[model samples]
Target: MKLTSTASRKLAALSLDEIKEAQQEASRQFEEFKARGLSLNMARGKPCVEQLDLALGVLEALHARSEFANSNGDDCRNYGVWNGLPEMRAIFGELLGIPDDLIILGNNSSLQMMFDCISQGYTHGYSGCEPWCRQGDVKFLCPAPGYDRHFAVTEYFGIQMIPVPMLKTGPDMDLIERLVQDETVKGCWCVPKYSNPTGVTFSDETVRRFARLKPAAKDFRIMWDNAYCVHDLTDEPDQLLNIYEECLKHGTEDQVLIFASTSKISFPGAGVAALAASKRNIDDLKLRTTVQTIGSDKLNQLRHVLFLHDADGVRSLMKGHRRILEPKFHIVLDALEQELGGLGIARWSHPHGGYFVNLDVMNGCARQVVALCKEAGVVLTDAGATFPYGADPNDSNIRIAPSFPPEEELREAMELLCIAVRLAATEKLLYERAE
Candidate 1:
């Protein structure tokens, strides 16, 4: 039968013979894919080669003839600017919508800075508060289908993770509000703009609610990891509510620590990362962070500032990125639509901008689908990697990172993925029918 996109028909709606035929066709395609011995990967959200080439000039931005002093004449080659170069902070300050005084630059990984925040809370706590480790049974709110690294950090710290439902607007605020009422719920991880995997930015109401949350712990923090703040796939992308600004309005500015990086914007390994928070939080972070190192790589910060120039420069660079990325994303979306659009067995996110496309297959079928893809020589991010402890209770959500591969390789991998989704879904329906 010819497929139509007008409406979806569930696999359960098909007769046994029809389901068997569909499964056979999908199995045949899977075997053909396997025979090709394709070694394609869509597992990590890495920038493609073209994207990496865009920042080659960042290396040239600084040279032997260039002065190594920051705007304040502080020698970037030497140690001392424990926070960061003044000009670099100014650039991110404007971009992140926080004041210059509130931003603190770190090494390439914001994930490292996040880990430090949790470590400090565990050992020293935030600003005179008792250490979290000393406290009994600490908990954190984890919005599922989130950045797996975020979940991994919380898990490594031995913090109990509470799963919260992520809605199209954002995580369920009603549930988050209720969970944070307990003092043990010390913090929550947030990717406010073009969230990892799901690519759903928080709504204005959701950001405001997050800011106004009356958490029982004074030291409670909202780890706002806005990694994709400017990674817009379209000219007019989703508008993210400024959580730091909203936090200030609610008199809870210290409650959220905002993070951003130039990883995808430029070189991932050599990019600069920054954290923004209230003065109190900044000072507290400085006190703990200073002992760890004399300072971050100010020369690298200078390289970025000199290259990116300012916020508009960052935006311009991202426009180039969108040019390279947008088409690749469309390839995946189009392949999914053509192959599985009218099959009620699968659905996926059509994000305006982000590094990933979140795909949700029929319940109890994601693992099987991923295994099938693997057997066909196409690797995917494991089915449940989006949730805390790598467990998606429904076992349905799969994070598709389409940024790493070339367009043609990506299209091939995605087509194989759709076939696997169909085969696994059909097998599931048939199994249920037999039962």
Candidate 2:
């Protein structure tokens, strides 16, 4: 029997014999894929080589020694500007919609900045509050189908993580609002724009609700990670409300810590990272930085400033990225639509921007699907890596990172992945019927 016609039907509607036949066909396909000895990885959202090539000019942007001096006349070779060069701050500030004074440019990884921020809170605490470590039981509200690394940071510090369901608009605000009433809930992690895994931007109402939150802890903060602020895949991209500005209206400016970076736009390892917060919070963090180190890599900062020049320059580079990335994303989405459109076995997000596509398969089958994909040599992110502690209660929600592989490789990977999904779902149904 042709697997396409048979597999296209809902697995639940198939008879026992039909289900077994589908599984057999899937096993046969899986073995063929295994025989190909294909080796492809879709684990992390690293930019493709083509995307990295677009920023090659940046290496040459500072060839001359005289270019070492920033527009503010600070010697890039020196180590005194703890908040980063003014020109670099202004450039990222424009992209982040933050005032230059409110931003502090840091090292290459925004993840580093996030770790530092959490560490600071754990050790020294924010102004007017005791260190979180001393608080006895610290907790954070993590939005599910969220970034695993964010959960990792909180877990590393022994903070209890409370998983909040992510709605179409954003994290369930009502639950978040209720959770924050506990003084132990110190903060929440938010991707805000093109959120990790789910790719759902928080609705305006959700942003407003976040701004108006009256958490019991005076030091409660919102770790607003806008990593994909400019990584749009379409001409019409999602707009995220400025959480800081909204906080200002509600007299809660100190309640949000915003972070962004050029890790994806330029080069992941050598790009610039930054954070934005209220003056009070910035002043506190800046004072702490005085002892952390003399300053970040100013020479690299100068190179980025000279290369990117300004916000428009940043946008131009991103457009080039969108051209290469948009089609790759289409390949993944198109394959899903054609292969599993009405199978009733899976559903996924069609994000306008960001580097990931979230795919949630049949209940209790994500691990099996990921394992099958791995066995076939198409390596995927671990099945439950998107959730807290690497555990998805439903055993669903697989994050697909299509940004790294070349187009042809991505197409082949997706084909194998869809087959794995079909095979896993059929096996699951068969098991349930037998049970």
Candidate 3:
């Protein structure tokens, strides 16, 4: 009973005979390394050429000497107000269903804006308060298997990172509910829709629970990064619960902050990013940002607005992305199915949208598998890069970004990756058999 219990607990742990049989079968297929002429990368979650082709009109509109005036008539080429051009904010606000005044515009990437917000809290803090840099010992709760950049920012500021397990619907709500009780927990990172790597979306109930939570610290915030807000790779888009409405209904309107951007939709390095928050939170945050910078570039925002007028316009763009990207997703999914399906060695998500497809290899084999992929002229997002601190505690999770490369390249790289996974897993099984 004890031996069976141990064996079942770890699919990796097994007897010598079991591993020997696995290796014997695998060794038959291990051809000596051959020189190849392939140079491929399946790493970054960037948009493909065809997907970027959809937004060429935006670039054409922003050509030199155009009507580059803001709603307030500020010249697009010069410094002006800090809150961004009012018309641009209003346009995206309409796109996201929030009032324009509540949104703070930022250049292209929201990461710079988020980093600034967190840094201000570190230096001077929310609303003329004592900076955390002075207080020394600020900490944030990081949902494990989260976006690494989120963890990177908090780590850069010397903040302690507490890892919370991520689930299909969202981060573990029970753990999140209990941990934020401590005053040290300043915030939690979230990607509410079709989360990176895993392709899991937060349920409406999970969103509701998040909005209703009462943290002990008044300064506690939920960094609601909805990067994939409109990124649907399917013909039918899944309806997302309006987080702004949910927070207001649950009496935690002031407790959460929202972020969204048009990077994947329009142009990644050329799109606009915004933050949506309660009036109180906005009032508090603006106190720090208003003085530092003149404002975001109005010309860029205007281009986004002129090109994408409403929510429907934005949704229409996503449908285009879905068409070009869907086949590429199929390429990887089909490869995994043909090579490793029912092999009991690996499993990967067939995401409906978002830039990543998370893969889980047999435990302890991720590193070797990734190495083999590289050796065979394929590059992958590093093994453990998905989890906090660049360490997958389970060492099983691997992020697959299917959006960057062309379908043909993705197919080749994915094929090589599967061969590597099988080889690594079989090697693992054989090692177990020896002992």
lDDT (tens digit, per residue) of candidate 3 on 262-343: 9898988889888988898888777777777667777787777778875678888888988888888899888887777766
Give the candidate number with the greatest lDDT. Answer: 2
Quote the lDDT for 68 in model 2: 69
lDDT over C-alpha atoms for residue 263 of model 2:
96
Give model 2 RMSD, 1 decimal. Answer: 1.1
- 2 or 3, which is superior by TM-score? 2
What is each predicted model's overall lDDT from 0 to 1?
A: 0.90, 0.92, 0.79
CA shift of 358, model 2, Å:
0.4
- Give each model a TM-score: 0.98, 0.98, 0.91
What's the true lDDT of residue 15 in model 1? 88
Error of 1 at 304 (Å): 0.9
Model 1, clash count? 0
Please give, for residues 186-293, the per-residue lDDT of candidate 2 as tens digits: 999999999998999999999999999999999898999999999999978999998888999999999999999999988998999999999999998987887998
What range of 10 consecutive residues in model 1 has the weakest lDDT sum? Answer: 1-10
Q: How many backbone clashes does candidate 3 have?
A: 1
Supply candidate 3's per-residue lDDT for 136: 64
Superior by lDDT: candidate 1 or candidate 2: 2
> On a 0 to 1 TM-score scale, where does candidate 3 land against the true structure?
0.91
